[model samples]
Target: MLIDEVPERAVRRAGAAIELPEGLLVLDADSGEFGRMPKPVADAKIRGLSFDGARMVLVGGRGTCLLRLADGEQCWYGIPEERYDEHADLSPDGRTIAILTCDEENAIISLLDPETGRRRDIWSDPGTASHECEIRWSPAGRTIAATYMIWDDEMDDDALSTVVVDAADGRVLAGPFIRTHLLGGWLTADLLSFREEYDDLHRLQRLDTTTGEVITGPTIPGRVWAAVAGRHVHEVDELEDHHAEDTTFYTTDIGFADRRPLFTLQPKVEVRYFFLAAGVSLPPSR
Candidate 1:
């Protein structure tokens, strides 16, 4: 269902949520009913949803807050004095939260404790700025993959890079890999899928974080809008008719086999921001 004037949306394994101008429209997976939950903080933006759809992270003009869907319980992060343009992701185990924040000079990734409202910076890179600054936690919750737009003073342009770090102590495990963008969640604890420009076409590729091995996957037929759960690839294709377009959201294995079409959007709408709960099965589109 396309919602007019909705600015943001997030999809989980069991349901989905839309950010309306008034409030958050939540689709309850268990009841198969829709409900509206007032934003915990005024003008807060939905950063991410937990795997089970029980909790969500929101960032607002004030700070970031964690909302419990069961009772609307709220836990605000301790860093209210810091930047407001932060992005957050809840760990799979529901114990830790990853927060990505950046300023004009540096990019920072930190871990937060929901219960105690404590935060610790895990990694910080000076002289680099973030583009999307999206972070994804591995299935085991042991590592994080982050996207950044690094400024290249020599090239006089910004370059895309993906960095993988240890979730525990902020050790660099794999990258600051240049010119690669993370495709989806981790396929495994060590494997990540990404895309790189190859002869003017965007081609899917896989990286083994442990061994520094790279493997080229299938060539994408159209532009890949998003990838989720390391298996489903959301693609947008311009139709032959100029006035309309088609957006195909499908799921496939790591090898791009056993392809399945989950849903398609005709006369495509511009999706400015959308996120899928990583490592979770998306309920079949109804």
Candidate 2:
């Protein structure tokens, strides 16, 4: 390994990611602390990972994990700690995990108790409703926000809709509403932000979980961002075709392409950088 030309021998499977001897690492420049992500859960590629103070959820293609981590490394489970691993959505309180599992014949959402690994069928799809992304806990920890709908098969995007389930009993509280994006947010502790069509463009709208009300926010092309704190360190990926072509012969609007402000994006390549949010260095994949 080379830390600015200081050479050192690196062992096999100990670098920066799995499957290729590479592992993920975390760095907090403000605190001057840096470390690699603990080897993937049981060495499985993490399809999704999120931490919200009390709970840590790791979602993968083969399996999933529900555990509480202290200081990002310590595993805190008083029980046997083996059965809570499943493809599930972790509740904000770290108590319940809502998993949509199916057999060759049926598909249902199973409300799972991570501590005991006990599960109960909360909801079932009569048609062909399968789960999609954005399965998460509301900031208040009372509602489970997820998306599911009928489609052709595994790779098809059709009839995508959002549902807010009651975490306690798995009751459908609100929505089966049409949504174009599998995107939602906890804009506030009680507000759940979702995307919907607003006129000719898509907009971000917040739903008040308590009052069944709605409030619209900014519009986006596909995605947008806002900085809560700290600053982001970025690397540009400009297209070779991007040059002094003020008259590039296009009948469309300008965007975050070559000459963009937020960040430069290129086709067929990923631009991974560092997002120093509140101290944690978030991995940006190119």
Candidate 3:
């Protein structure tokens, strides 16, 4: 039994779930063949993907391309070698796929028309001028909030700015507040949530979309992360050392009661991660 003869196994599969014309991609953790779906197309190593009504937008180490699943003949590519996510959202009734990729200077946000393979720059600064680090659109589809990390070569200092803007015209409406780690999205239509400085506390906080006032949420201890499930917020507070972690613990409150152990995750491989992808509906603030 030679070491080379042992088939190379993927320790993990990290990406978003996207649909093809045939069927939805299967993503079962700790499984066979590089988290590939039953379909033959899943065999292609992809970094990220999002399917709109007419086209499938894909981004990976190779490049960003759009494929028309009809006859498997339609395809287009422009931006190459970058990472994207659901952040590269395909609008419900539109033909544009907007995605963000990191260039040397700032986070380059662009929109791609899968049909023509035309890439349009929505917001991006020329190398090292001012980096648009990240952008997240409101679930309502009317506003966009982004983190702009600014660097000064003259003084050798760094500044962080967060802003909410009109998704359509790109008009700045909110604060360019000094913040990072946008933990939650659209707590209210006029509010956004983020995490405080990791050293002081691991807690959830909110920023007023209009006035840019800081509002505090629940405070959990020890490098914690949270996800909103229906009516409750679930928290994952990690134990001492994350590496070589066997059993991972998490907690959540069922009702207006005590927060108890929601569950424990056992990792078969050395490298492991716990991710929660959820969508919660929030009412507009009055």
Candidate 4:
């Protein structure tokens, strides 16, 4: 591994903020900061961020939109006025991007080229409702996993399901598995980690993707709020700053294909008043 470098300065710039959108973020690899772009909100909301290192894509309302960072000018490529409003992901080569699409009534998974801006609908599942969460891609770029839920009128509540799709043909590979709430998820070549939300508590589970088996027990406890995994570090949130003076190591894949941001995002907030406001929630004092 290359020598770890000092953390670079963070750039906190507000782009477009949309309601009920995914909180996906993109970062500049060199500066370890978010990509500077003009966020003009249309009918779409950006829910997740994925990259081939050089190119960044935002997935959310209205399908997957492409973002390119090259000669200092940030450019965006998108479908003209057609909205997809769900989770979107990119292939490993950065040539094709995928999205779980709907227009408040019909739903399908679509793919598009970032450079040419041409789109094709690959999979249409009419049974899929418009209420699914973010979509995740397998590390090999061959499959996609998404949360699927259906209402059983006899039970009177929604039953959750998870589905994995074959990227090549949009074939259902694994689930429709029952789950409660899926918060965030990531995939490795062999391992898959996911956070599940239950009531007010969050649980993290690690799974073996090949066998579709759980490797660790559920409901890991603590105030662990933030987590990002790589080959070098599995950084978890702690009450106190652990690496204040030390450099953080970032692992990289060859061919510059899979490059992640080298710096961790740190946000400092000052809360002036706590329990005085009516029905206002406050963060615990550090």
User: Whose lDDT is greatest here?
Assistant: 1
Q: Pick the candidate with the highest TM-score.
A: 1
Better of 1 and 2 by TM-score: 1
Measured by TM-score, how close is model 4 to the native structure?
0.58
Please state the error at residue 85 of candidate 4 in Å.
3.4
Give residue 101's lDDT in candidate 1 (0 to 100).
75
TM-score of 1: 0.80
Candidate 2 vs 3: which has more TM-score: 2
**lDDT string, candidate 3, 14-127, tens digits:** 222323343233232323221223332453322222222223444444445554433444353545444332235443334565565556656555667766867766665432
**Can you write out model 2's per-residue Cα lDDT over 59-140, one digit (the tens) per residue?**
4443456433333442322222222222355554556766655544434566767667667776655323343334556656
Better of 2 and 4 by TM-score: 4
Looking at model 4, the pairs that clash are 22-47, 61-85, 62-83, 62-84, 62-85, 63-84
Q: Write the per-residue lDDT of candidate 4 for residues 186-257, one digit (tens) a residue.
A: 435555455443434444555566787764444443222112232222222242354344322222221113
What is the lDDT for 250 in model 3? 39
Model-by-model lDDT, in order?
0.66, 0.43, 0.44, 0.44
Cα lDDT of model 1 by residue, 41-107, tens digit: 6767777778777777777655667777666678776553545446778898889988777666777
Question: On a 0 to 100 scale, what is the lDDT of residue 216 in model 3?
Answer: 74
TM-score of every model versus the real structure:
0.80, 0.57, 0.56, 0.58
Model 1 lDDT-worst window of ten: 5-14
Worst 10 residues of 3 by lDDT: 277-286
RMSD of each candidate relative to the true structure: 4.2, 9.0, 9.1, 11.0
**Candidate 3 all-Cα RMSD:** 9.1
What stretches of model 3 exceed 4 Å from their correct place?
1-58, 65-76, 80-87, 91-95, 102-106, 125-134, 152-161, 197-199, 221-235, 239-263, 268-286
Candidate 2 vs. truth: CA RMSD?
A: 9.0
